[model samples]
Target chain A: MPQPDVVDDESVAAVEAGLDALDTPTERRRRFTWRRAAAVVAPPVLAIVLLIAVWQALWAAAFWPEYQLPAPAAVWQVITDNVQTGVAFDVLWNSVHRAVLGFAAGVLIGTPLGLIVAKVRIVRAAIGPLLSGLQSLPSVAWVPAAVLWFGVTPSTVYFVVLMGSVPSIANGLVAGIDQIPPILPRVGTVLGASRLGSARHILLPAALPGYLAGLKQGWAFSWRSLMAAEIIAVSPQLGKGLGAFLEEGRNLSDMPTVIAAIFLILLVGIGIELLVFRPLERSVLRARGLSGAF
Target chain B: MTATLETSAMTTAVRLTGVHKSFGAGRGAVSALEGVDLSVAPGEFVCLLGASGCGKTTLLNLVAGLDRPTAGDIALSTSRPAVMFQEAALMPWLTASRNVELALRFAGVRRTQRRERAGELLELVRLGGLGDKRPHELSGGMRQRVALARALASAVQGSQDGSPALLLMDEPFSALDAITRDVLQGELLRVWRSTNTAVLFVTHDVREAVRLGQRVVLLSSRPGRVVREWQVGDLEPSAEAAAIEEINTSLREVISSHAAA
Candidate 1:
């Protein structure tokens, strides 16, 4: 027969009472409402509106001559005409398609390469600093090498994109793995987890925020590299990518088209960040009690 | 539970003999433990007591198989021990139930069974309704209880050919307020009595050692050796006060001499 100790039930009951009264310190997620949405969107909207007003005022004042700073009306006319003719849509589709393909390829190559490098000391020791060094080299600098290797082909554009992005993705995973607390894996080990199991269950999940950060950076790199390659290695074989379009406008001295392309690039970059990366980072940060500050 | 009780008559849960640990090699080597021997038998509640740097935790780590002893024999009849660190060490991404379920998952429990078992473990810790909450959402004491639940899950799991379970707790309630600590101490005793798992608890508090341990082993500082041992398992609550005072007086003497040195 098993003998049980007569526990201090009153004390247990007391703590039980205290448990309910213990103030929950974790902040409840701020509710999303129309008002909150407006509060968030209002400032940015005002800033953009103010920017357009200033641009119109500059055009009215005829600052920097018509050739250098085209009238706001002329820029608007270009955007409206492109929207109607669907030339802007085709340019966007072509550039975005290339960027998407290159970015996917970068993720596939970089994620595994990062995992291997982060876990294996020999690999990390050999190429850790080399990888970070690669990040500092402008992706545009790869245009010449890519053109030499693949000529004026889509393969050349992708080659530059891969060189630009792979390092960042690998670097991010390494950073994420490094930042995981040593105790978590130690705890995992004592719980009878194998080395690989510990890394999977504890290290990887803990390092998710950092990996996501890396992915976001890698996308930016991919876009930049694609544009650089497009500008340098422009060919009808590569299609009318945004970079080639911008280059063409420059060649033709059509200032409005160049400005329009610039806007499109900024919008795409901002859209990915807002639509994809921001939600990912927000959920992770909020779970870790880091959302408020970070 | 019956299996653990059956092992009580013969096998020891963990045995450490002449254990020595040094952090660095040669001239800079700082010894943590030297010529230490300790053992906890099946279903035993043993507490190792010492001040900071007394190598209590180092010894526990060695026993838990987290580190290797420099020159000693350490044995555990149990397959692998479960550890509850001072910090909760809960996965922030997981809910309380999922955190417990992770141990079950590692143990190769059926996917369909994990959720129910995890819920039962959470309820065992008196955290029944709070299973869905995140670690950050809970109070410090609640988090530690969930951590304790996780440790328990590990203990009962992965027992192949019926190896006994050993639980290593490193000052698990030291961060809590005095009242919460007291309540948890009671809860621990109650749980220990029910579960029949061997516990090797490490703490510096003499009262806590006396309160929780069937056998309290006091270690001396400076490369930590076994200084004294007490079998205080059968004391009454009234007698515990005097016993605590006696232990405190001896600890004070040891501290004074060290301070004078």
Candidate 2:
């Protein structure tokens, strides 16, 4: 397309946008800008500092004794103590392994379920409301039933995690499929695409962002459910995961240790989101030009 | 070569007979097309001219196999046609090349051949060197051109017997600005001439119909049926002015009579 001598503002914007897109290299080469980096890193750091300051102030005031509300330093000391003994790392690893394994299972089970619900009208009509209803019911509700079925073993925790995440993954896929523009199917039909061919090429790719969002939510649910099962269900066979560690601290009325375990759980959840989901989302949005900038 | 061209011209690319389309049923049913009959010979350009609710789009949809007629037959000599809507329906996620390649992939073009063919088609539309850009990155006119490229790719890749393509465009350039529309129309004419594609171009614009179509078919509103038609060949500037004047008179009469009814 050539530039016309006389152009409107809208056309000018379109041309500029097109030129920007064309100029983009095959590999994205973003310059390291300190200001932009600071814009991302500042808010969370500031919030943590503020939260600690508030915790210290209340501790200093001796509000309801140190046992009930430990000082920030007390929790910090517990983290350092356990980390020095390498118990913290081991505990963290045990919990993450369960969540990741269960999340993988959720992906395997839920994806096909989502597709089936999306495409098969009869299946969707039968299972649709139940799937959503299951999502709303916290995975903790399934612990007792899972224990009765699988007993106080690692399988109980796995079962609970699967229950927690599958609905979200399936429902996410369904929503993604629903968002596909009707034109894509017509395009496929005209171009002589078989139903399966179009499903592979057009439907799946178009529904990806929504599915990614679902996967993120599914992972969160998996972690939460695993933690819940670990807290409630006692297993001599199972190692002390974060949930069990927190439970042990409560049993002993060890507030600082409990708070440290809570922090570790939060840290892992945040780490996975930052390391995995954020990058996935940013790249997707950037490719589609849905992001504010490349 | 002349014999083959002559034979192709004599062959009917599309034929719609006694096509009746009515939405809903009984008392509330709205009739769109009643007793509509039309045909396009291979290599012919026919513009369906009508007001809103005149079943021009409905008729096009019927021909494209997107929808079926309530009563009647629509026969096509060629494979399924390539349709371009009023809105350029380019997939936003794919780059310009990939969008065209998607049609090629569906047309059963091998992975090895798709890229070169896509590049060739893009070059044909004068959209060379911009294949990697996404749909939103392109201007409205450019997007429509990519859509045209996709439609062309579909036609070529389909049938595989080297059949002359059939293109059904529903007000494809109506959304564009005046200058951009003129530029695209010229490109369209060039492309059409090169491919010898049979086209059924629908538009509400009378001047546009007279300007583009080899023959303009006037369809009446409210139960659309062919009211009149005019053959317009070699629209030199002088002839274009006279054709426009005649089309305007007939168009106004159609609108006025519909309003009275």
- Misplaced by over 4 Å in model 1 are A1-7, B1-10, B158-160
Reference contact recovery of candidate 1 = 0.61
When just chain B is superposed on the true chain B, each candidate scores a TM-score of 0.93, 0.93
TM-score against native, each model = 0.94, 0.91
Judge candidate 1 against the unseen true structure and give its global Cα lDDT, from 0 to 1: 0.84
lDDT of 2 by residue, A191-242 (tens): 7789899889888888898999899999999999998999999667888899
Per-residue lDDT over B58-154 for candidate 1, one digit per residue giving the tens place of the 0 to 100 score = 9888877788888888777777788999999999999999999888888888977989988888887788999999988888878888999999998
Determine the C-alpha RMSD for candidate 2 after optimal superposition of all C-alphas: 5.2
| Chain A: TM-score in each model | 0.92, 0.89
lDDT of 2 at B22: 90
Candidate 1 per-residue lDDT, tens place, A1-294, comes to 112233567658666557645745746657779998998899999999999899989888987777778876787788889889999899989999989898999999998888888999999999888999999999899888778888888888888899999999989988998999888888788777877788789888888888989999999999888878888888888889889989998999999888887888888899989998899898888887777654
Query: For model 2 chain A, where is the 10-residue window of minimal lDDT?
Result: A1-10
